[model samples]
Target: MPIKTPSELFIHDLSDTYSAEKQMTRSLPRLARAATDPQLAQAFEDHLEETRAQVERIEEIAEALGLKLKRIKCEGMAGLVEETLSMVDQVQEGPVLDAALIGSAQKAEHYEIASYTSLILMAMKLGYAPAVPLLQATLAEEQATDKRLGAMAEASAIEQAEATS
Candidate 1:
């Protein structure tokens, strides 16, 4: 296999995120539908919108840096989403399922948070200041979405579980 340079790695990171977000736009609606809880559903919907905007920002940043956006086929995201879907599939309508679903969703968000953080640092190191804010914007949205998922998990997961029991 060919080794990637540090700069190549940085661009690959951006490409990976772009691929993940593009795939996620398709996945979010399925997640929302799988979620039995209204709050969980709404969270997915909101993040869908946010994710689209994030993709746009990343594209803008790529353009400013004279780089074309590409896909590295983010296998991590694909696996995570696939696992979440399988987990949710077995969940019966109740709080436990809602809680489990929320947990899965949050796990996914945390992955995105880590990916974006590293990408932002790389962009800055590569002298892409304009890319910084765009990265920051996506980072903030990912964080916000993660936080929202956490809140939903706290409020609904256990309570729903108890009620179902």
Candidate 2:
């Protein structure tokens, strides 16, 4: 459907985020398994649960708005997942791979942060008051996840990879 109004645009963006969350659910497990650092692996696992809740929040927003989320593919997220997996295949599994995974995960987190920021602004503008909090909560989670990944990279992944090289 062509977006004819701000409301339609909001729904379109929401659906895109829904698709991205679904894709993350599918890809995160592989990332968890591939991560050699126990803490990093556990972070992936933890985020998977958060992602599931985030999906539910989006559903709640959709139901509240009386909008059915479109069955759309978030190509942006798909590209990120594909690029991460491809990088995984090219790198040898270990600290280097862990570093790569962190980089990929951070990329995803940044993407999500931007998406959620837009979503919150759109929700507020479209008078989707209920959705603003939900979107904000997810945005916080994404930001926290990005911070955690950055800390992990600094604490170990990058350093370990550098030492190995």
Candidate 3:
């Protein structure tokens, strides 16, 4: 174990988050393809585009701070992704697939919201407001996606489930 300063901890978290976002860029495509709903697929595509901009923002924060971030494994996200992939295998047809996908994707987005919110607060307290906004920007996107997913789930998913039953 290494004794880490607050700055080091901040940097470590940033690196982990960076890797998580990068991982999503790849994962989102598969999710898009697996989606039974065209809307759901398009949502993933839009998110992937937003995610790329987020990566740039994070990198900008790293450069401004004179810190180099090394990609760290985010097991939580990896597990979430694996679960989603597994769900795809299990739910291959019908509206249930889209419902489940919205559920799984929202779970992932919630995790991201928590992570970025925490990171922003830490950056602010660490006297790094410039980085704070960068984290907040991502946080906002995650929240928006969550809201959008919730709407989709309510409008289409639940109705579909009821119809099938």
Candidate 4:
């Protein structure tokens, strides 16, 4: 995993993102169940589906490249998910929990956004023509998910959590 070229970097990033998305697919259900807000729960559920599709898209990229998709353990995502899980167990289940969920989920999205942005640049630099669009599509979804979470936090989750406290 010596990053000597842009292509090498791109593949490394692809593996990292693949691992992160896989982890999200598994962890999102817990987030959905912990959410007090029905809309928030639904959002997590919907994102779980989206994460699965993202995984497929990454697999397709690997297939096209004639490379086996190898997953590098994404320690960053693991830490974020672990913190969120801890919050779920320690916090009271209510709007506060919902707000914390949104915060944690947003952190995840931001990590994804940064990761994909770098990957897209590396792909383009390496003349990875097919991967550019696939990575872009995932990046756009991550950005949209972040925006949705922000809207939920602004419109309800945060305010409700504050009111409860």
Q: How many backbone overlaps does candidate 2 show?
A: 0
With candidate 4 superimposed using the best TM-score fit, by how many Å does residue 135's alpha carbon deviate from the native?
0.9
Candidate 4 lDDT over 1-165, as tens digits, reads: 477866676777789889999999989999999999999999999999999999999999888876666658999999999999999999999999999999999999999999999988887887778888999999999999999999999999888999999
Candidate 4 deviant stretches above 4 angstroms: none
Q: Report clash pairs, candidate 1.
A: 95-160, 95-161
User: Model 1 — which ten-residue stretch has the worst lDDT?
Assistant: 1-10
Provide the overall lDDT of each model, using Cα atoms, as 2-decimal numbers.
0.84, 0.96, 0.88, 0.92
Off-target runs (Cα >4 Å) in candidate 3 are 1-3
After superposing candidate 1, which stretches have Cα over 4 Å from the reference? Answer: 1-3
Candidate 3 residue lDDT tens string, 1-165: 463798888888888888889889989999899887799899999999999998899999999988899757888889999999899899856688889889999999998888898898889889997898778878999999999999999888878966876
- List TM-scores for all candidates, in order: 0.93, 0.98, 0.95, 0.96
lDDT (C-alpha) at residue 76 in model 2: 100
TM-score result, candidate 3: 0.95
The root-mean-square deviation over C-alpha atoms between each candidate and the true structure, in angstroms, is 1.4, 0.6, 1.2, 1.0
Which is the winner by TM-score between candidate 1 and candidate 3?
Answer: 3
Candidate 4 root-mean-square deviation in Å: 1.0
Worst 10 residues of 2 by lDDT: 1-10
Tens digits of per-residue lDDT for model 1, 1-165 = 353787778777888998889888988998888777788888889999998998888788788888865547999999988988888788786677778778888888898999999998987888879889888888998998888888877776778688778
**What digit string (tens of lDDT, one per residue) describes model 2 on residues 44-162?**
99999999999999999999989999999999999999999998899999999999999999999999999999999988887899999999999999999999999999998988998
